[model samples]
Target: MTEYVALLRGVNVGGVTVRSADLKALFAESGFADARTYLASGNVRFSADGEGRALKTDLERALAERFGYDAWIVLVTLAEMRAALDAFPFDASDEARQPYVVFCADPAVREELLASAEPSDEDPIAPGPGVVYWTPPKGSSVDTAFAKQLAKPRWKAVTTTRNLRTVAKICA
Candidate 1:
């Protein structure tokens, strides 16, 4: 069984809420082993053996059926998750910045993000294997230029982001 993480997008926000326990239960019920949710934000770690696309489809379908919401998740193997953590290129220790990893379900989307933004002290973005590592200033991530680009509706279907701190906890 390979370990996997399902980084659910837009959960616990925008009138959608799923209890952590329920999220874990949904994964286990879907036939994953040791399904554990790191926080109420929908980081579910589990063990299963399947191709990535199949797993993603099954998980998303299960989530939608069980929770009655249009669910989306960035499915990653444990190694991929670790690689994203190790490839973080920003000063995560900076008290004034918020570190984030944006998982791109499509490689094209990742490239587009890299090409769309110019690095700055306020919004620095770097490309990783299948992700975009970002460190936008604390309390201002919502206002950053790169952030505004992400807010566009077109990116919603192919991207989901997680705070690096939360990601570390999930990996831990």
Candidate 2:
């Protein structure tokens, strides 16, 4: 069985919720083994033998049926996760700043996205497959022009923002 991380979008945010234990049970019911949730924002780690794409679709369908809401699931294998972590452009030691990994479902060219924005301190960098890294500028800075632009496309993607501590904890 391959270990995979399932990033779920638009679930359990704000006041809307799904209990982690229940979510784990749901995954177990769907034939996943060793299902565990990391953090409260719908990141699940599990092992399964199916193709990632197929598993994504299945999990989406299962969540919708079980919870009465549509869920966008992005599946990443352990190897892919490691690659994403390795590809982070900024040094993880910089805890004073935020680090984000935006996972694009389609292999969209980084140049295309970067060209859409003017380079600034907050500019995002894509170092390798399926990942974009960004560090936001200071206080109440609504300078996430890249994120705003990306959101407009309705692309099959999800952004997970984590500090170096969380990343280390997850990988460890």
Candidate 3:
């Protein structure tokens, strides 16, 4: 069985809140083994024997039936998640900006989304398989154009972002 991390998007934000225990129970009842939740960001880790897409569909349907809401569950295997973390584009010592990974829900749209983005000198973005590594200028003094561009509907609907620190914790 592969250990997969299912990252739930748009939860615990804008009035939507779900308890971590309940989320883990939901996963367990849905037939996942060793179901666990990390943080309050709706990140669930579990072991299962199936494809990522199929698991995602199952979890989404189960969530809709139990919670009365449909959420996009982006699934990534342990190896894949670690690979994504290891592929960070920026150097570790670079303090000028903070690194983040925008995980694409669909590989088919990865290129399309990257192509549509226009990164400025303030933020240098790198596109990887199923992930985009980017860094916005650090501190509150710098303009957040790149971050704003990411918040736009085009990318927001299809991608979920986690900072380098979060990614490290997840992979650790």
Candidate 4:
């Protein structure tokens, strides 16, 4: 079985509460092995023998059936997750306490987002296959343009973001 990390977007927020235990149970019931949840923010680690997108579709379908809500799910192999973490763009000092990795649904979407990304020098943005690393400027309270851009409805549908530390813990 191949290990995969599933990131659920807009879950456990805005009065929609999906507990980690429940998520794991659903995964286990759906024929996944070693299903585990990393944190309350909808990060799940599990093992199954299937293609990534197909597995993600099944998981999202199950979630929709269970919760009656349309949720977006991003799935990546453990190796992919680890590689993305290792390839973090900025040096340690330049990184924020909550550096974010935005996971795009497909390579085309990734490229589209990256091509239009406008990051300031203080908070640089780096793009890789299926992922983008964004670091916020230190001590800058103002929201970065990248953040605002991602918040737009056009961008929201195609991507999900998680802190690097959270991704590390999920891999761990």
Cα lDDT, all candidates: 0.88, 0.68, 0.80, 0.83
Ranking by TM-score: 1, 4, 3, 2
How many residue pairs clash (N, CA or C atoms closer than 3 angstroms) in each of the candidate models, in the order given? 0, 0, 0, 0
Write candidate 3's Cα lDDT for 1-172 as tens digits: 9999888888888776778998999999888999878889888888999988888888888877776775777788878888989888787457887778888888776787678777767778888768888887677323566577667776654778877888788777
Please state every model's RMSD to the true fold in angstroms: 1.1, 2.6, 2.2, 1.9
TM for candidate 1 is 0.96
lDDT of 4 by residue, 104-133 (tens): 888898888888878777668888657998
Tens-digit per-residue lDDT, 31-143, candidate 2? 99989888777878889998887898899899888877757776788677777777778765664556666655545544455555554665545545665666654342244
Could you tell me how far off, in angstroms, the CA of residue 143 lies in candidate 4 after the best superposition?
Answer: 1.8
- lDDT score of residue 131 within candidate 1: 96
Candidate 1 per-residue lDDT over residues 1-172, each given as its tens digit = 8999998989999989999988888887788999888878889989999898899998889989998999888888888988999889888899988899999887898998788877786688889989999888889878989999888887886789999988888888
The candidate maximizing lDDT is 1
Q: What TM-scores do the predictions have? A: 0.96, 0.83, 0.89, 0.92
Candidate 4: where is the Cα deviation over 4 Å? 93-97, 138-142
Best by TM-score: 1
* Candidate 1 lowest-lDDT run of ten: 113-122
Checking candidate 1 for backbone clashes, the offending pairs are none
Q: What lDDT does model 2 reach? A: 0.68
lDDT of 3: 0.80
